[model samples]
Target chain A: MTEPTAVIHDIGYRHYDGVRLGRGRATLALGVQSLRGVFGFGRTTRAKIMPLLLMAIMLMPTVVSIGVMALAKQFIMPYPGYAVFMQAVIAVFLAAQSPYLVAPDLRFRVLPLYLSRPLTVTDYVVAKLAALAVALFGLLAVPITIQFVGELLVDLPGPPHTADYLGALGGAVLYAVLLSSVGIALASFTPRRGLGVAVVIAFYMFTAAVSTLFYAVLSSTGRDDVAPWALILNPFFLVDTVQSALFGTAPINDEGYPPGIAACLILLAVIALAVTGVLLRYRKAAS
Target chain B: MTASATPCFATEGLTKRFPRVTALDDLTVAAGTGVTGLVGANGAGKSTLIKILLGLLPPTSGRASVLGLDTATQGLEIRRAVGYMPEHDCLPPDISATEFVVHMAQMSGLPRTAARERAADTLRHVGLDEERYRPMGGYSTGMRQRVKLAQALVHDPRLVFLDEPTNGLDPQGRDDMLALIRRVGTEFGIDVLVTSHLLGELERVCDHVIVIDGGRLLRSSAIREFTRAEQTIAVEVEEGQRRLAERLAALGETVAAQGRLLTVQVSADDPGRTHDAVRDAVCDLGLSLLRLEQRRGRIEDVFKEPVA
Candidate 1:
């Protein structure tokens, strides 16, 4: 038998031959990617519509508040109380948009792809939570910044205005952390975005309704003293309670706000629970 | 192999038991470099073993190591070094392949600029052209598999675990994917642990083959050794094939005539004598020796061998 001739062909396959940045850099990159994912960047146009619309809805109230303040020479929306004024809109935004951060990854079984990378489960959880927190922070900061700039432009009393602006900035950061943790924590459980959105909204709406009902009953029964206990159950009321205590914003509800220490403790507990939930959820094989 | 040269992976009495059933049972094996085909039927613990090696699942007892890194403790390091293409369809539908692969490259610790450039190169290498820009939701099964392969290789891993990559592909698609997998091993020099339930598909590309049955290793050896010549020789004669077979049988040789050819069992005491006897019988009978060939063992023959 004749021997067969051998030939070689170039496939243009090259090795990376680059420095690997390791797990820390990997976690940071995942965080940045998830952050962009939250805003629907690099996703389909249909994916972008929801985040963009919710963002616009989130900004409209601030734009209107800023416009009113500029024209009327009065603070239409208090800086610290802005999240409270648009609590439902902000809640809706968190409920609808936060799932975009995690649910799709879970639904698509892409966790294997990630866990197979240089990242650990804890790193994944941190990256996702950080991304959502940053997105939520950016989401809320825009409105707060608009209001702060409006206050500065209109020359609303310098000392108090600057102090309130700083306080509002701090309050926005707190709100972003708490709300984003809760939203993404819930979203991570389900693979379906619709289910994620529904579960989140149901959670927010149910707790708010229950808190309102319980507080109304207590006030009607002449036990107004205990009404503050009911407001602590709802995240919206919890945020309002904390914001009022933190920035010294006037209470928006008829039931008196919980004391700063009590509100802070409860908010911390909620944040802890949500963050723990995120960690525990990822502790299992996500795929 | 030298003592300094570690196998791609080695397992020692590895066992994994779920709540209801045991998936892997005391599997002890070592896979050397080059393409190693992991052949097992469905539900034979192939995926379970892969998960344990990936450090995604903890084995119930014993230990495993990938690239000399202990799977129990150095899971992240193992993952960092190895790439995996899952058996299922796991691509996100809303995102384009370019964006998704870039994100994965970045997630693998590449900087943004490096990730994008690597993703582009990797996609091109996987045969995804401008169509990489389109969302994966509309991609064909073949395209989706290419996308999956692109993501796995984009990070330039030292080894890759391809679990049933040709699962949903057509015949032509399977051939193309197998060719690509062969290129990955031969051209790129990346060690591969590819799995398939089909017995013969991997015979062409793999240097070694590992066969697992019911979660236990049935055999692990070089493909060439596994398919080594059996103690049998196929003989043909130009004319009087039956007469030649009769003459060979009369010479105290076990012979079975199969139409134009005869299968002679080589004497266990002296295998070379069987070939000599056949030539002598053919020469004496005035019959021309048409063809003489030794039969090689096939993968299917392993199943027929009695379990030890």
Candidate 2:
């Protein structure tokens, strides 16, 4: 038998000599990728339908409100009331897309790939939460900004109106954080994306319906002072209460939204709980 | 960095206990640079040890370290330095290989441009070409395995832990995967800790062999040491093999003769003298020497023998 000769195949596996940005940059990369995922950036065309359709629905009111003001020479919808009017649309958007950001990773068992990187479990959870918050903020802010800009072009509502619009923008940031936190936290537990959507929507519907009924019952019985407390149960109501306090606008519900301090504390408590749940669910490196 | 003075990984009294079963029991093993084979049966704690080394799971007791960093305290640092390819499928179906690998490279701290470039290079290295742009849901098992391996190597980690890389491949596919793994260790100068349950699969590539049974270390040594030739020789003659065996036995060499072959046991202390005696005995008996060679021990022999 002839002796076998050694053969080398040069596949050109080059060593990476570039700088590694380490854990912070890894977390930032994760956050950016997840944010892109929420809108179906690398997904199929069909995957883009829900998020785009929801976004259009959320922005539709602002466009129609601006058109009404242009035709009738008056503000059709108050800037601070945007959250109150667009609550359901925005909630649907969050419910539909928040699961897109997290559930796939869990169901597909891709967390091991992420956890085995330079990233920690805290970085993983924080990056995902921060991504949802940023996406939700953009979703709520862009239309408000467009409306604010449109309002400026058409007519001058004066300095007070400008201040209110600015305040409403700030409150939009809070709304984004609170709403997205709750949506993502609820979606994190359910591994199936479809089931996650149901859980999120049900969470919103159940709390809003129960709280509204309780408020109506309490007000009819003449316990008006305690009726606002029922609004605390609904996340949308929490957004409205905080928006009213921040922009000095009238509350959306009949029972003037919860007292300012109590409302802010309740929103903070909800955000804290949601964030805690998210962190706990992803505490394992590869769950 | 190339394989440094320190070992690739080391564990001391490493034990992991699930609620119902003990996954690993007092596994104390260390491997230096080069391709080391971690051979074990299914459920033999190979995956468990890899997870602990990657800092994806904390050991229930004892201590372990990878690349000179503690698994518990410096997990992030260890992960940054090491890469892991899991035994099971973990690729997401919705994304393309280029997109997925770029995301993973960036998540390993590579800048965007670098991540993209490195991802392309990694894909090519793994033998993926234009098809990389297609979603991985359509990829075959071999292609999927290659994609998984590409992601593990895209970050240019110093060492890699590959578990069952040949788990679902045909004969040709397994051969190609093994060659790729060997090149990763030799050409790239990266240390590797590869696992397989097929005992003979690792024989051709690994420089060191580590055998584990039920999560405990069975044997640890260089591949040569494990498969070295024993103090025995096989003698084949054209004829009179029984007579020749009797002659060798008369010389006090323990002999067992087959039809035309004599199996002679040589003295461990004076093997060369025994060789001369056998040659002299074969010539005196007028038997033509057809073959004379020492018997090489196999890895299966160690399993048959007790720990000594």
Candidate 3:
């Protein structure tokens, strides 16, 4: 047979098995591809440089917080506690940067390049979320750990005993995961990266502001009892509630640890639903 | 051309619908070996069909297959064997061609070492030169298109779908691209499904041609069938053109003068006789023969027919 004929025969035999790579293998390959894509490997240098720049920017708050504590410790007291400061920084970073990470691949039709490979819609979504979460953790972890060590060195009273470190780590991880999911969910609604960024920032900042405004109104009106319930309106507050509990803050008069846990559970459920919606939207957009 | 034992690509009643448009509607065509041109105007469903075959787009109705694998269920399998050069410019501007093509090869399941080797070979094949190491953002349109083609072939796919590969090229660039495409299909032994709006361009290279209009199949046949041998021969003479025409008609040939040339009809099976008769008649008439050649129908002629 001629070379072309031989190729045809080879293709035919290859097709007999139908799919050469099993589903599990294909999924794993796709996941790796997505990680490579998100990290900008084998793509444009901007893809490589942009993520680096974004991470650096995300870590900016850590540097700023550390500087403020070291240089002007007398004025910046309570230090807002490292957990609160780190949480705020992460919220801002996700609001500003997460959208850019996920939106462009779909908006610019770059998703076809990924989808054309063995990658599935779910794999792409998971990879993106994982990438953002990892970046967020890197940004938050270094500064928080530094601040924790610094506070110890200065012999300052910390928020919790050493016994609570594990719980605090768990709380931070939970918050990071939820934040990543929420950022992706919001980004999925629009293809425009700038718009996605703006929307996410607004979603995070606006809900937090509204929840605060509601609490202030309730407190001024002598209804401090109802402030904890009002906190449920904000996902960030749910995160804060968990942090506050980990730090052994005063429990709400009406409800105890179970309510805060329930609220966190509810927030997680929302994150799951939002993630599902995003994935479905991505799949539809791909098709 | 006789029917091959198996078709390179075949589709049946493929349909796809979007909210704003019916992108592909009951389209069906079968293509054999060599370069097959899928010609259609913009928004004519050419891209849609290519995407469906690649399993990028799910058909709302009907069925399709590539290399005998079902597109609906085994798109990944088909993609592994069928390369695709998309029409859009979506390259990451910062990465080098080496990195991009290697990643694509790896994506198609090649090992790291093999992917790198294939990437280098394919990039050289596309004539990227030393600029392959530079970022793609600074490259010219022609270079970008070549890079896209290189990545598509980096996996050594058996068949490839090149959508509007020459869309942004100048005439010379377009010619070069067409030549390269011909080499890929013929010299490299890869079956090519290339789409173009330029009918004349495909006429020179494609072994088969499939015309589509309004998301529907109009015609699909070998290029030879589209440009079949005509019974008429066009004759041009330096002098005695009128006398030559008169002599040809006197010899039982039906002839007509088209400007300085004469068109003579002959029996379909007697093409050699028609040529001899024309030469004899011109010589006897003492006329200087300028040109004598059979005229075949162009692919553009088929475009003039009503869509079926």
Candidate 4:
């Protein structure tokens, strides 16, 4: 028998001498990847089911309103009112998906992998916040844009007003920032995705119910001044107050705009608080 | 600094104390670029030292650096140049290995195309075949380990701190992983600091071994220095062990007798002479020779005293 010859293959490990792109590009990739993850772009069919369904549901009213505008020769749904109309669906999206984005890293202990990279704790938090904000912006802006375009396509009582459309676009930005801060802040605390979903849903429902209930009790009791302040309890109402004050959209709870720029201040404060919650949660997780 | 000039990592009186207990107590050691094994029993602070060196955790008292970057102030730069494969199961269950590794490569600053190509190359290098496309939820422990390893290498790090990489592998998987670790240091040009509780396993792949216990450095030396063979021969007889020991000891040979085994010292001047004497004495005593071989010192011997 012949002795076997020992041969080594030029395989296994290969060194990469390409462009690294450094921390800026790494943070950008994390943000883009996270934004794609929010709507289940790179995920499975089972994962794609929830986000896409919620989107279709969100667009349902826009389709119906466009059909109404075509047949009745009048635009029924205003661009700014589309999100408030589909607020429940938007809330469900946030509750279901914020956990999908944040919980896996904590549950599986993958933060070490990310923190071990060129990314810092603050970098991770900011990227996730930015992703959620951008995603939420898309959720609101798309339907609002379709409504504007649909109004232009149909015969309306008046031509689609560009000023109001721009106002609603401004409202979408406020809603995006506020909702994302709240969504990530709530989801970061619950590591178990199942529990995170429940926590978010419960948090939104509790705050929303409390705000509406307090508004009803206070305004009906002639305590009108204190009633609009209660609306700040709900996240949608909080942003909607800012939207209503700035863009002159129909206020959902308050009779009129809350004082002057007090609504905007309240929103900025609440956003700051929720963002702090997110930062603290991540700091603890990283440590 | 050039990669070859500075050590892979170094510590200066590094100490990390938790609220209740200290994890790394004044560990001061440095290793060159090679497969250096960080070995200790469980809870011996091997993982803690790696974390401090990776700049993920700040040492309570002292300082550390990897590739000349400080662990505290220059953590981001250090992490950019270093890769870490955590000991635990860190893979997200939903994504395929290819997608996960690609994202990780990008997170480590690799460009998109480079990330993809390196992900494939690294996955194949780690022996993940078509299974790289499969979701990691269904992977066995061995495959998951390979995926973890692939992610660490996907960005082509200059050095990698592999924390208990062979934690849950079978015997064959362990051997394959050790061989891959050796190749990672030499063939890939990436220095490695692999940790294990099993001392015997690292003896095969490590160019140097560092032994720590109770958060303190015990010994650090080249592998050859640790495993240098003693001047002794191990003799085993089928029967008449007492007669053989008596004959050898009477012939002025140092013999330590056990049940059926004997260790006879070989003189430095006449090594073959001692072997002949043992063989002839056993034959005269009519004891059948079962085995005769030189005694080689083991890495495990360092722990024998403390363990007993």
The TM-score, computed over Cα atoms with residue i paired to residue i, of candidate 2 is 0.85
User: Candidate 1 vs candidate 3: which has greater DockQ?
Assistant: 1
Tens digits of per-residue lDDT for model 3 on A144-219? 5655566555443344234344445555676677888888889888878789878988887788788779877877
Per-model CA lDDT versus the true structure: 0.84, 0.85, 0.72, 0.85
lDDT of 4 at B74: 92
Calculate the i-RMS of every candidate, to one decimal place: 1.4, 1.3, 5.6, 1.0
| DockQ, computed on Cα atoms, for candidate 3 | 0.20
> Comparing 3 and 4 by lDDT, which wins?
4
Stretches off by above 4 angstroms in model 1 are A1-11, A157-160, B1-4, B229-300, B306-308
Model 4 spans with C-alpha error above 4 angstroms:
A1-12, B1-3, B229-300, B303-308
Worst 10 residues of 1 chain B by lDDT: B295-304
Ranking by DockQ: 4, 1, 2, 3
Cα lDDT of model 2 by residue, B27-92, tens digit? 999999999999888888999999999887789898999988999899889888888898989888
TM-score: which is higher, 2 or 4?
4
Which segments of model 3 are wrong by more than 4 Å?
A1-81, A145-162, A243-258, B1-6, B17-25, B111-113, B229-300, B304-308
Give each prediction's DockQ, rounded to 2 decimals: 0.55, 0.55, 0.20, 0.72
Model 4, A120-212: lDDT tens digits are 888888899899889888888887788778888885776576777788889889988888888889888978999999998999899989988
True contacts kept of each: 0.85, 0.84, 0.26, 0.95
Residue-level lDDT tens digits of model 1 in A1-287: 97869875654888997877889998988888778777888666787887788889888877887777778767777666677777888888888887877887888999889888888788888888888878877877887787778777777644436666677677778888898899988998998999999999998899989988998899889987888899778886787778778777666676578788898998999899999998888877553
**Residue A116 of candidate 4: its Cα lDDT?**
91
**lDDT score for residue B216 of model 3:** 85
* Candidate 3 chain B minimal-lDDT segment of 10 residues: B294-303
